[model samples]
Target: MRVGLTGGIASGKSTVSAILRDLGAVVVDADLIAREVVERGTPGLAAVVEAFGDQVLTPEGDLDRAALGAVVFADPDARRRLESIVHPLVHQRGAELEAAAPAGALVVHDIPLLAEGDRAGSFDEVVVVDVPTEVQVERMVRDRGWTREEAEARIAAQAGREERLAIATRVLDNTGTPEELRRAVEELHAELAARP
Candidate 1:
């Protein structure tokens, strides 16, 4: 099964992805791929520089994510422009990884923007890690050390909670303890693995 796993920032999606990985799922992580594609010397980085200019690059010739984030998150047009350059590359790379997975492997694509990108239907199952927006904000503030405003801004940049839930084939409620979340994921794994 090809599973698309997604959730808002700090919604415990990464935790769920890690558990799925431990349980033998072939996980293609889009966030990791996004960073790799934009690393210095790649065509991805070159395109970004050409679009956003050198202000978006670091002194070491790396993509200055914070600087770019500050620009894109605040401007919808800028965000869309960045997406136009990056999304196609990410989708292509993700497809390549998915194709390399062994036959019958439960391939999970951990894409943060699955819903935002309208790509949920591309997967066999879309598993949304659901959490309230407030919980997400609190988690971001406490764990990531981001200010509430920053957390809110990042959240606003993605699809709304309702929008994500609407696309979910299965919703993993993550408003509970870690143990509870783990148990839920294990159950989900068993269920998916049982599919023939």
Candidate 2:
């Protein structure tokens, strides 16, 4: 089965994806592949540097993610331009990973932005890691050292709770302890493996 796992920023999607991985599902992570295709000399990084200029780079010459983010988040046109540059490359690599998984193994593609409508339909099943908005803000602050305002801004950039959970074939509520989350994922793994 091709499963799409998604969630908002700091919503514990990666933790759930890891649990799925330990159960032997082949996970094709979009963020990991995005970083690979954009590493320094690649065409992706070169395109980003050309479009955004040296101001988007650190003194050490690496891409300064914060600088590039400030531009994209502040300007819709700029954001679209950045997405245009990165998404195709990321999607291509993700597809290759999924295609290369063993014939009988389940492939789980964990894409952070899958709730944006059209993106969710590609997979046979969709899973979303959900938590309360306040809990999300708290976790981001405590774990990521993000201020309340910054945490809210990052959350605002993604689909709201309604949009996220509305598409879920399985919703893993991660508001409690880690053990609870593990139990939920274990249940899901068994259920998914049994499906034709």
Candidate 3:
């Protein structure tokens, strides 16, 4: 099964992903693929430098993600440009990983932006880790060391909660304890594995 797991920033999606990993799902992480595609010597990095200029790279020639983030997150056109360069490469690598998974393996694509509509139809099932926006902001501030305002901005930049939920095949509410979340995931795993 090809599953897409997504949630807002700091929505504990990683925790669910880890649990799924432990349960033997072959997890293909989009974020890691994205970084790999744009690493120092890749074509993706070269394209980024061309589009965004050398200012987006560090002295050692690695992509300075923070510099790029500041540029994209503040300008919609710039963000689209950056996506134009990176998304195709990310998707390509993700496909390679998915193709290599064992037959009948549960391959989960942990995509933070799966609900952004660009990746529609990319999965057999879509599982959203649902949490309130305020909770997301609080968790981002507490866990990621972002200020509340910064957290809010990041949240606003992504697909809204309702938008994500509307397309979900399953919604895992994470407002409660960690144990509760784990239980929900375990149940979900059983349900998914039972599908022919």
Candidate 4:
């Protein structure tokens, strides 16, 4: 079975994904593949340079992620242009990994932008990890060191909770401890496993 695990910023999708991994599902992470595609000598980096110019690169010749982030997040056109270069490569790599998984294996694809990108219905099932907006802000402050404005900006950029839940086959409420969260994953894993 193929399921997509998604949520807004600071919604604990990675934490839930770790639990799912422990339960024996093959997890394909799009962000990880994105990094792979843009490694030092890859063609992806070349495309990024062509699109955004060498100013986005570091003195060490690798991608200066902070610099690139500042550019795109400030300009929608810049972000879209970069996404045009990166998303296709990321999706292609995802398909390759999905194809290579053992037959009938349960796979969890963790895509952070599934809803905003119009990909919510692409999976056999969609699992949303949710928490209160305030708690999400707190996490962004504590875990990610994001300023309040920065956190709010990212939240504003994503699909709203109602939109995400409207498409979900299952919802993982993540307003509890790690142990409680793991229990949720275990329960969901068992439920999916029980499905014929």
Candidate 5:
């Protein structure tokens, strides 16, 4: 089964992904693949440099994510442009990883932007790691060191909670304790393993 897992920032998607990994699901992490595609000297890095200019690169010849993020996060056009370069490559890598799974393996694609990109339809099932907006904001502030405004902006940039939930085949509510979250993942993992 190819499942897409997603949630808003600070919504515990990472925790769920980790639990799924521990439970033997082959997790294809899009964020990791995105970083790999743009590593120094690659065509993806070249493309990014060409589009955003050499200023986006560090003196050590690596993509300066912070520099690039500052530009993209503030400009919708720039963000789309960056996504245009990264998303196709991320999808290609994800497909390769999915194809590599053992027969009947539970392959979970941990795609942070699945809903935002309208790519949920590609998965056999979609599991949304859900938290209330207030919980999300609080976590971001408390854990990620994000100021209230920054946390709000980051949340606003993604697909809204209702939109993500609307597309979910399963919802893993993360408003509870870590043990509760782990039990939920374990239950979901068993259910997924039973699939044909």
Candidate 6:
């Protein structure tokens, strides 16, 4: 089964992904691939440099994510330009990873922007780690040390909670404790594993 795992920022999506990984699912992480594709000598980085210029690069010539993020997040056109350059490469790499998994393996694609990109149809199952928007904001403030405004802006950038839930084949509500979330994931894993 190919599963798309997604949730809003600080919605415990990574925690669920990690649980799935530990439970023997082959995970293709999009965020990691995104970073790798833009690493110093790759064509992705070269493309980014050409699009946004060297100001987005660090003194050591690496992609300065924060600098680039500031530019793209603040401008809709710039965000699209950056996405146009990166999204294809991410999909290509993600496909390659999925194809390489063992036959009959449960392959999970952990993509933060799954809903935003309308990728639910590509997966056999879309598992959304659901949480309220206010809870997400609180988690970001407490866990990630972001201000309320910063957390809100980041949340606003992604698909809304209702939007994500709409695409979910299964919803794992993560509003409670870590133990509760873990138990829910284990049950989900068992359910998926039992599929024919």
Clashes of 2: 0
> Residue-wise lDDT of candidate 5 within 110-172, one digit each (tens)?
999999887899889999999999999999899989899988888888889998999899999
What shift in Å separates residue 130 of candidate 6 from its native position after superposition? 0.9
- Each candidate's lDDT (Cα)? 0.95, 0.89, 0.91, 0.88, 0.94, 0.94
TM-score (C-alpha, index-matched) for candidate 3: 0.97
**TM-score preference between candidates 3 and 4, better one:** 3
The predicted structure with the larger lDDT, 1 or 2, is 1
Relative to the true structure, candidate 6 reaches a TM of: 0.98
Q: Per-residue lDDT tens digits of candidate 2, residues 77-98?
A: 8887887898899889988888
Q: What are the runs in model 2 whose C-alpha is more than 4 Å off?
A: none
Segments in model 4 whose C-alpha atoms lie over 4 Å from true places: none
189 in model 4: Cα distance from truth in Å? Answer: 0.7
How should the candidates be ordered by lDDT, best one leading? Answer: 1, 6, 5, 3, 2, 4
Query: What local lDDT does model 1 show for residue 123?
Result: 83
lDDT of 4 by residue, 1-59 (tens): 89988988899999998889889899999889889999888899999999989998999
Every model's TM-score: 0.98, 0.95, 0.97, 0.95, 0.98, 0.98
The sequence of per-residue lDDT tens digits that candidate 3 reaches over residues 169-192 is 889999999999999999999989
Kindly report which residue stretches of model 1 are placed more than 4 angstroms away from their true locations once superposed.
Answer: none
State the weakest 10-residue window (summed lDDT) of model 1. Answer: 115-124
lDDT of the structure predicted as candidate 5: 0.94
Index of the highest-lDDT prediction: 1
Name the weakest run of 10 consecutive residues (lDDT summed) in model 5. Answer: 150-159
**Alpha carbon lDDT at 163, candidate 6:** 93
